[model samples]
Target: MKKFLVVNAGLAALVGSSMAEAGFSPYYAGAAIGASQNNGSEAQFCDECTGSKFTMHKKNTGAKVHKVYAGANLNPVWGVEAEYANLGDTYSLDMYRPEFGIPGGRAETARARQKTRGIGLSAKANHRITRKTSIYGKAGAFVWENKNSMDYTNLDGINEKYKSTDRGVSPTVGLGIEHEVTDRISIRAGWDRTFNTGKGDRFLELDANKNVTDLHSVKTDTDMIYVGATFNF
Candidate 1:
């Protein structure tokens, strides 16, 4: 009985030491760079004119995104994070109103560009699948700002430029997998999405007397995939 007790005590100590070595610290910080796609539609309508409407569909507008985040682990399974991200730019081109009656039979064209950035706060849940591998999911809210500009040209060689800035808060969600390379360092890959990020309208046209003649509105969602490294403290 004495020998058995001694062996059990030694085994307990070994187990405790292993647990301590594999445990995560309370705080961590990381940075990630990735590609993002914005999905949405841009529409222009003239309430005062008949049959003067145009709609542009934007699908797969890709951009580069980078972000930095810091978080505290409340326990082994739950944590919270704050992040700032530069979500990048999306561009689109549309051709409207083909002038078949004209000699060249050309069409009126419009080009648009939009830029976005945001800060977010998130609650994260982690599940460990192995000694060095884990998966996580996060839900959060993001406050975003969007800058939009458009240039339109008509068959008569008249050019118009319009700009607008819109700001709003949107819901965000993400899922990821992480692997520990050492006690203090880990690497992760994930996908994140922000919904209804761009939500507002812009004036696309004005009359000779400076009255609002045409209006444009757009709504978009952004998605990103990234790989990054984190350090625990």
Candidate 2:
């Protein structure tokens, strides 16, 4: 993470110095919506993960993503951009933890959610493929923050909650295409991936009467694809 920060700072300083000497920069900003897919192999949750027996269930996978970015298009082939991206709070998972003590097989309802948001700064390189079309790639650093929460409801109408929040810095890489429909407007399609948070080692635990337990683990790394319009000034 420190390396990512150092690299970006150096690049930013270089860009600032170059633009200062040239006295001008082409600036633009845009918004996009996409699907953020949670990698299956990277995160796994089990109710009895720390016990002799384990029960596992699937969590929400593909989630809606939104991003807004502004940048200086320093030249025809290179630029620098800053972006804010969010996965909101729509993704969730539900499970049931059964207890034999209830006689009629009583169980508690369980639900959990992990929401992700980040701020990123990137250096982009564009390659013209046609008269009005180009392909581009980007590399950047993002401070990814995630909020994880869990809730439990018993048959007797009691509620309990567990929650945790953490942030990490990771590298982001992407490839995209742009088509200029007019001199000042363009259509873009892109895919990007943010590296793992490296802190998925925690779990949520809810205990009722010291007999039944519900546990859940979470991770919030992201892979996404998006389409949006860019308005250039």
Candidate 3:
């Protein structure tokens, strides 16, 4: 009986130690720097028409903007984040209204240079899958700032400028893993996604006869891949 009691006590102590090692909480904050890809698509029409009334038509013109960013993460399980992503100059397909008959019988080419900066906040939840690894998903809001410049040599052999700063709310979802490399340090990696909102879309007018219009009613999604070192106190 005495030996059995001792064995049970030893097992209980071991279990307690394991639980201590797993140390989890409702709050944690960290910083991460990563590479992200912004993928967006939209359609356009004359404001008077409900996208169906326009004599000009283009189905789904899209763009892919790739960038690198650094940011801090705060986890209250319902917290906020501030990140800055720099997009150098990403290009995409620019279509025009084929129905509009031109004087020279030539279709205009539409193209431009674009860069984006994002500042945002989010809410997140963490699920511990193992002693040193966890998975998480997040959703939140953001304000994306866009700057666009256009070149319409096809229309007037001249350049134009169209710039605007718009406000938008975006939602994000992500998964993450944490591994303890030591008692004071750990390595973490995660992927996050965000869907952008209405004011997020902008239009560009190249020349009087032609324009490259952008309609981003459909949300733009961004994917992030990051690995960072963390300090636990």
Candidate 4:
């Protein structure tokens, strides 16, 4: 019986040592921010014009957009994050009316500044390669809305107006690193890229038969750099 007790005590000591040497836990929650950019394109033409000689007009624009976001991390090397950001003016282009007898005077202009604001939720998984550093990858979807408007005057003293709102999905992939400062705090830095696919609509005012047209499809790709803190719970 004494020998059995000694064996059991040895086993318990070994177990305690192993637990002490295991270091910190695996689960964490945090936030990050990085540089961002956005690009979009749209086109509109008279839809009611049935004549073969009708003119076609188009416009394309692009610019740089920047914003920031915040999120949280979960267990099993996987976490969820929510971020909000706004992109500045990217770019703009204008196309004149085509060379047809469509009687369309000036082409559509891609000017007028634009902005973006939205929130995104994503799921991420991370692997620890060392004691103080780890690499992680994340993929998720986001819903974003955009509003664009343009105004111009025609030769016939008529005013033209165009505005649109679009909502779609944005998929993202990112790589990041985390450094632990204490048992309750850590610093994180990461870079992520996302592709947004969708289109924006437009409204045109024309006296000839109340014309309406669908604008062009727009796609955007953005890169961001982020650094933030995390609290382990």
Candidate 4 global TM-score: 0.55
Q: Which has the better TM-score: candidate 1, or candidate 4?
A: 1
lDDT values, one for every candidate: 0.74, 0.70, 0.49, 0.54
TM-score of each: 0.74, 0.74, 0.55, 0.55
What is the Å distance of residue 102 in model 3 from its true position? 16
List the candidates ranked by lDDT, beginning with the highest: 1, 2, 4, 3
How much lDDT does candidate 1 score?
0.74
lDDT of 2 by residue, 167-186 (tens): 77889899999887776678
Candidate with maximal lDDT? 1
Backbone collision count in every prediction?
Answer: 0, 0, 1, 10
- On residues 1-106, what C-alpha lDDT tens digit does candidate 4 reach at each position? 9999999999988765553233234344555544555443333232343343433332222333334444454343666766665543321333334334344554
Candidate 1, 38-108: lDDT as tens digits: 66544422323334544344446566789999998877789998999877764344546667645456667
- Report model 1's TM-score to 2 decimal places: 0.74
Give the alpha carbon lDDT tens digit for every residue of 112-202 in model 3. Answer: 4444556655555656676667665666665665555444434344454444444555665666777777765667887766555334343
lDDT of 4: 0.54
Q: Which ten residues in a row have the lowest lDDT in candidate 4?
A: 54-63
